[model samples]
Target: MKGFVTAGTLALAFVPGLASAAEPVCLTQAEATSLVAYALPQAINGTAKRCSAVLPAGAFLRQHGSELATRYAGQKDKYWPQAKPAFIKTLGADGGDAANLTRSLPDDSLRQLADVFVEGLVSQRIALKSCDKLDLAIDLLSPLPPENTAGLIALTMEVASTAEPQVGKIALCKG
Candidate 1:
């Protein structure tokens, strides 16, 4: 369960603009869930690489990370439509120039940029000590369908947003 928090942190790292926005960008539930589904596989792969040395030989990430990533990756195209608009909105909240530039790019180019950005950020932010716990967490949650995993994360973020409305953070909008 603690590792779930770590997972959330990894997902949040993808939104560097969230912490610097003048006003929070609100994502609808669908948008938030789609974004999580889109990012989760990359986060898993990045963490697996970043923490490989510290994780035990039998760790879930070491043994199954690629498989898990592939499973989630399968859903990427399905989630991308909703994720893109939400992502662009977040960029708009960050600044006009960034939003314009992001919008200017084709979807294929934007997706590539996003994938690299998320993997790099997730890898850099993960702590070495947390690798074991994250491995267990990934293993625990791996059985669920990707949509369920994504929904859980989106729900968690929604609860957190309601509990603490940070000015520059991303929030899941209330229906």
Candidate 2:
């Protein structure tokens, strides 16, 4: 959060007053959901009919969509501390376990942001098999901000190579 930024492509390149001086603002679970909702539609074509066909935005996403989309679109590489508030709020009590599980994994947002980035993929029959896995895109290469991107990629590669999913596995990250 303290250092001068290394600029990258993604949304951060165009957003002003961010990526330097401090870490990017982290997206809340609600925000992530909303932004993912927002991003999902754009990422996938003809998907809106399905989402709208479903349960709707639910309560959290509907109320927080605009602000969440702004923060998510604005800050992708925010520092851990900066990202913490939103993560905690989003994950609630479940966060402690997830954070602890991947504490030593990596510094990038991959382990955390991956799910956020690609949750919508689960809805798609094709994206899931095409590019949803950690090996395909990796976290750093993902559209997310930089702080966690590189580290997340490393973690994903490690996980993909070493671990095998047994149960219903959902890696939690914000894409």
Query: Which of the numbered candidates is closest to the native, going by highest lDDT?
Result: 1
Clashing pairs in 1: none
TM-score of every model versus the real structure: 0.83, 0.24
RMSD of 2: 17.8
Error at 8, model 1, angstroms: 4.6
Residue-by-residue lDDT tens digits, candidate 1, 1-175: 4444665554464354443456777889898788778888887888898889998899999999999999889879998988888767766634577767888899999998778866776788677877776787778889998889888777766655554333226687878
Q: What is the alpha-carbon RMSD of candidate 1 to the true structure? A: 3.0
Badly placed stretches (over 4 Å) of model 1 are: 1-23, 92-95, 163-168
Tell me the lDDT of candidate 2. 0.31
| Top TM-score hit | 1
List where candidate 2 sits over 4 angstroms from the true fold: 1-74, 78-81, 93-99, 109-118, 121-175
